[model samples]
Target: MAATTIRTGSGPLTPALAQQIAGDTSHIVGFNILITDAHGTVIGSGDTSRVGSFHEASLEVIRTRLSATHSAAQARALEGVKPGVTLPILLNGQAVGTVGITGSPAQVTRFGLMVERQTEILLHQASLLRSTLQRERELEDLVRSILAFDPLVTGHSTLLDQANDQGVDLTASRVAVVVHTPGRTPVPSTTSEWLPRALVLLRESFQHRQTIAVSISANRYVVFAHPTPDGMDGILSQARHCVEQFRTHLGSDVEIGIGTEGAGPTQMRTAYEDAADALHLGRRITRRSVTTIDEVRMEQLLSGIGLRARQRYTAAVAEPLMAAGDWNTVRSTVIAWCESGFSLVGAARRLHIHRNTLIHRLERIEHLQGWTTRTAVAYLALYLACKTNEFDAAEPSDS
Candidate 1:
């Protein structure tokens, strides 16, 4: 014989889900439960033998989309039904299925309604969760397109139209911020799992209507937010707040870099590059959690030089000191003197030494290098070389 089919407005209910709902309800209420699709075909039942059977009362409930109660006499008059209460399962204002409890009508009538309500709630929650996940994926894709920085891949005109449809104005002053969490051992299998949580924290921190955030890598997230009128300071403050929020709520140690504000979509790539450069320079120079491109402009400029050229410049400028036997002392003396604005007393105090001792060191440096901290050009060269050395030393080594 051909199998019977049940149809609901939302579509036919799956037998597996029906069976699970029936089993859980039976366990809680201690009653024999039967679940039938809209056509009254018994898809699931607490009594396994009753599965795949037809129930006349369930058919009546489905037809009327109402609850029905049957006594022993009424059940005997109907086919394939016992003394029980049958409740219609409705989804979107249409009967989708039926839940029946087989027992004395007086005892199980209330329990039947309870089971119907629980089943409806479970289905509603599942539907909502599915919708939420779908929306998140769509937003993530849009963000990836925006950050991709490749015109051929992201189709600039199409993206602009989509952003407009989504109520986002790409032609606005915005800063790009990158949050990086270093030292994560054995990176998680899926970084996207943590991204939603991070977005939540960012939304709370920014409190702005037009912010876009997405994870660009396993350890980094990119955010674009419209800047306040106060300019770079305002952007930096927000970046610091974001760093604190991630650390406080997510227990993550993060370094945040804020880019110079770009006026429109065309400048987003430049802003992102600036933020990335700021992050690299900040990590090299300071222990601060938040850094802005403006704070590292000099380093950013210096970084544009080729690596070999920078190395050559450093070697040529500081070659005398590099050749000294006691290079460490000579370098420290020059650095301290420059940092103290070429003040003998200040440099001596910073070195925690007597004036004469500091003078002796400076005199030795001059004798060994033929260059003195007395000249602005010599001091500037030494300072730049020292910064280059610091940058090289701070660069991470690969195992």
Candidate 2:
């Protein structure tokens, strides 16, 4: 889409983006406008007939990088000329094109300058978008390379050289974040219109920091994120905000899994795997929309058991009581108590109940579950079983 964008001030200014700028500026200002490339060929004009024609007034402005004005009398001096003001379209201090207004030079000078500034702003935005897309594609390739190859295997040197050429520091600290939509394994499709929209949201949302995100599949996005000097908490906070945005805008309950920060391509690949694992496990084992691998280390360790084994273990610890109507309440109380560091007062405060009431609920749970929750062994058993039940219920059922 180079023809649709100015390439971050580095490449030729093409007609598609120029036409867009012309159309948008004309709409805003209620004026007839024309855009000419540095070569003086009219690339865009409010009057379509003017396109592909020469604009004599813009040539001098393009060459001199300055505004040029012409009166009705001076218009006769040059072929295909008009009485108007033409100003150079400067992006990054280089004149890429010219924007002109057709009217009395004095009357149109203000409008011409206004449109010129607007065009520059639009051009800069297009350039930045082009850069962001390019970076995203490169990062996608880099991530795939890192994930697919080992350092000692064939093509390692090629991967290293590619990273170097892309100006990515392969050894710098990065955290992998996997964003996935609910209910399916990812099926990658490069042709999905959804891909660009998702990539734009991710790149723009994190533009303040160094984050490269790509649509790895139809519903899965991977981001290689770098934090500020402080730590990862800031980035993760931003990520949660993005999750909220996704829910509101994308019509999907998207979840994020964050991996611990690591350096080197190999470690970054591991971080990617960890992030994916966190998302997979978190969706099954918890109600959390955002999961960090560090926070789910125990769950990860426990995930190795077979589904049948998990089903039996969870049934043993959670059943009978689970058949009762107030099982959700009991489960919440158990979770709250555990979250409150096993303090009755803290748990009572969190549940907004009296301490005696919390004790009564705990006693009821112990009576029905056939195990006292006071002992370390029993407490661990009950909690782990509750989590296992969560995972088991979340799994896809067979007919």
State, as a TM-score between 0 and 1, how close model 2 is to the true structure.
Answer: 0.60
CA RMSD of each candidate after superposition? 5.5, 8.7
Alpha carbon lDDT of residue 217, candidate 2?
76
Q: Write the per-residue lDDT of candidate 2 for residues 1-399, one digit (tens) a residue.
A: 012222223454678777777777777767778888877778888877777777777778888998988999998887667888889999899888899888887788888767888788877877776786687688778878877877677365687688888877776677888988766543323443333555656666555444667777777888888865656787678678777766666655778898877777777788998898888877766659888888778677767888789878878888877888886787778878877888999999999999999999988888887764467567667888876665555665651
TM-score of 1: 0.71
Highest lDDT: give the candidate number.
Answer: 1
Clashes of each: 0, 0
TM-scores for all candidates: the values are 0.71, 0.60
Worst 10 residues of 2 by lDDT: 1-10
Clash number for candidate 1: 0
Q: Rate the local accuracy (lDDT) of all candidates.
A: 0.77, 0.76
